[model samples]
Target: MGGTWMQVLGLNWLVLSVTGSAATMGVVVMLQSLPVLLLGSWGGALADRLPAKPMLIAFQVLRALLAVVLLAGDSTWLIYAVALLSGVVGSFEGPVLGRFGSALVPKESLGSALALGSVLSSAGRIGGMALGGILVGITGPSALFAINAVSYLAVIGALSLMRTAEMRYLPTAAPADRGVAAGLRYVRSQPVVLIVLALSFVLGSLGRNYQVSMAAMVSGPLPAAPRRTASSPRSSP
Candidate 1:
């Protein structure tokens, strides 16, 4: 979670730095989410077929590698490419985490477990954002990327150390439930699930891009305040 937030902050800062155009930043942000729109259902189906532990580990490693790729160049195109790859990995990561998290506890404690997870996630995000801004200011955005790379190591270590024996694995989905179409069919059969999915899609796409919007605002109008602060000295003359 911390690493993901750092990547968010670093990626947005890098985009604005490279292009100096809010429009381009928006496009870059959209490109990062494009994979979720295109492959999220497929990814969820994959999580049902595969063991979540290994898949989650693999995706985290892939994400850390992608963070390393960011250090290879400063080109906007390179950033966009890495962003797209990160998004693809993220789509799979989400489902794996969700399925794995649910399996980690008893049915009676599931609600408490989920609530705790949300609290920790929110805390991680807040910490990562604050740390990211500080790191960027102190050592530039690359430092945040490097720190994010290291953060994944901690997650990988924790996951490796977890007791697999205690987990309550759901029975593997039947052959018919092993594809994107199967997931769609199941969702369609459950009206509540279908409605929740639709609402999430709508809200997620529209509301979750605050990093992009804020980045654009900061890069554009927000900096003007600092300039005005500087010009106050001139005005005093």
Candidate 2:
């Protein structure tokens, strides 16, 4: 999810740079999440019915294009629109990624494979966040968006190198007889799944929500600007 992290950092920074308001930043983040709230299970079902590799690649490319659109936009509204559109692509991609793990490895090896994926995701997030900060500091938010656009090529390269003939995927089934409402019913039937979803919502609201404040902090005069002993001109007073 390096691309996701970079996208988040770039969007927050771009919004803050345009509006200079934490409230606006928070609204942008909230709008980005609205699609997930609205389209959760259809996304999951779509993932289950599709070939994982192509879906994953297409979403990443779309995400990169959305980032490029944001980079080119001059208006905060366009940036927020791109954020929402990118989120729509990501909402579908997230479930496919989870399902793809099972297809990539045997049942016996699933735990280790998942652990490895989690570790790599964590590392990618760290790198993306750090790189986003450096690029935003050095060049600007638009450049960070452009860099994020380019980063998706790495995933495309990795996918191209994989031997898909050796991989395994379940046969695509017809759409579930149940509708989206049924999907919710199915989820509610599982207490653990419901609990996890609830916890995710809580964490997203409180913990992950700090991107708004981070946007506010980084958008204007750098936080360290006043303390730049090495670069400041002589005091006039």
Candidate 3:
């Protein structure tokens, strides 16, 4: 997750650097999320059909490969394409990892494991952003993308080292309770889920989407007082 965040921050900086256009940067960001909006349900369904361990390993590898692609060029089109591909990978990776982690512990310990995952997630985001900011300043966004690629390899290694005997696998979803339509129906039936989804949508759209603009400002017309900001003197006015 930290690596994911690092790549996220790095990609925005990369696009902004190459194009010098916040609107272009914004389009790349939007392309990443467009896949989630369009195929997220299908991703979750795919997760259910595949073995979580190998699926996660494959997802991690695919993400790593995408990061490597980002490292290869600064072409605006290449950046946009890789961003979209990363989003497609993440769409399935999110659900597969969630279910895979759940199976790692007994029902009694599941909540604690989830809480720990959440903690790691928060920590990863914070650390990744901070580190990415520093590294992108020092070595440029290409290095940052390389770091993320290696980080995914570490995840693949750890997943390989896990013990299959210890996992507490749950029964499969019934045929009647499967697919995108059924999932939507379940979400509609659960008021709490509906509310959470509504809030998430609102927060993502209104709050989180500002990163490109913020990055643009920090790296552009609204450059920071310090030289160590996302925009170097050479890149900024």
Candidate 4:
């Protein structure tokens, strides 16, 4: 997650530095998150079927490659393509991470584990952003990106070091209970689920993304477009 936050900052910085268009930044963000709307359920189901550790390692390697791809070129189309591809891969990888997490702890520790994971993730995001901001002054976005790529490999190393034999494997979803149709059916039966989904849709699509707004503010009345937009609210974690 630290690496992820670093890349997030670097990517937004890259977009702002190159194009200086908030709308384009918004498009890049949309491309990254759209896959979850399109393929989340399928990815969740697939995560249940795959071997957790191996798949997780593979996903990390792929993410590292994606970060490297950002460094390989600065073309607008290439950035868009990488953003879309990263989103697609992440839609699958995110679920696999959840599945892998379940294997590492017993049922009794599940709640504690999840809470800790969330806390650590938030901490990582905050620290990573602060560190990235400082590093941007020293090394620029390319170095941040390269460091992010290396961070993925560090995660791979940590995953490789885990003690697999002690992990408590959770049972996979039964065949009849898996798939998009089954997931849809379950969601339809739960009103609370529907409400949550509706709220998530509203919040995720409307409230969360502020790239264009920040860009406009920074470039307009603010008059510090480049530096501000690069580290502005829109780009912040």
Cα RMSD for candidates in order: 6.0, 6.2, 3.9, 4.3
lDDT of 4 by residue, 1-237 (tens): 877888887877777776767788888888998997799888999987877788889888988988899888667787898889989988998888888888888899999999999899999999988898788767878888888899887899999999888899677678988888988999999999999999998987788766557666766688755553443323331
By summed lDDT, the worst window of 10 consecutive residues in model 4 runs over 228-237
* Best lDDT among the predictions, by candidate number: 4
TM-score of each: 0.89, 0.83, 0.88, 0.90
Worst 10 residues of 3 by lDDT: 228-237
- Which residues of candidate 2, in runs, are more than 4 Å off? 171-179, 216-237
For model 1 the TM-score comes to: 0.89
What do the candidate models score in CA lDDT, each in turn?
A: 0.79, 0.72, 0.80, 0.82
Q: Order candidates by lDDT, high to low.
A: 4, 3, 1, 2
> Which pairs clash (backbone N, Cα, C closer than 3 Å) in model 1?
none
lDDT of 1 by residue, 1-237 (tens): 887788788876766566556677777777778998898888888888888898888988998898888887667777778878878987888888889998999989999998999999999899989988778766767888888898889989999999888898677778887789988787789999988988998898788878667866786768821222231221110
| Two-way TM-score contest, 2 vs 3, winner | 3
Off by over 4 Å in 1: 224-237
Model 4 off-target regions past 4 Å? 227-237
Candidate 3 accuracy as TM-score? 0.88
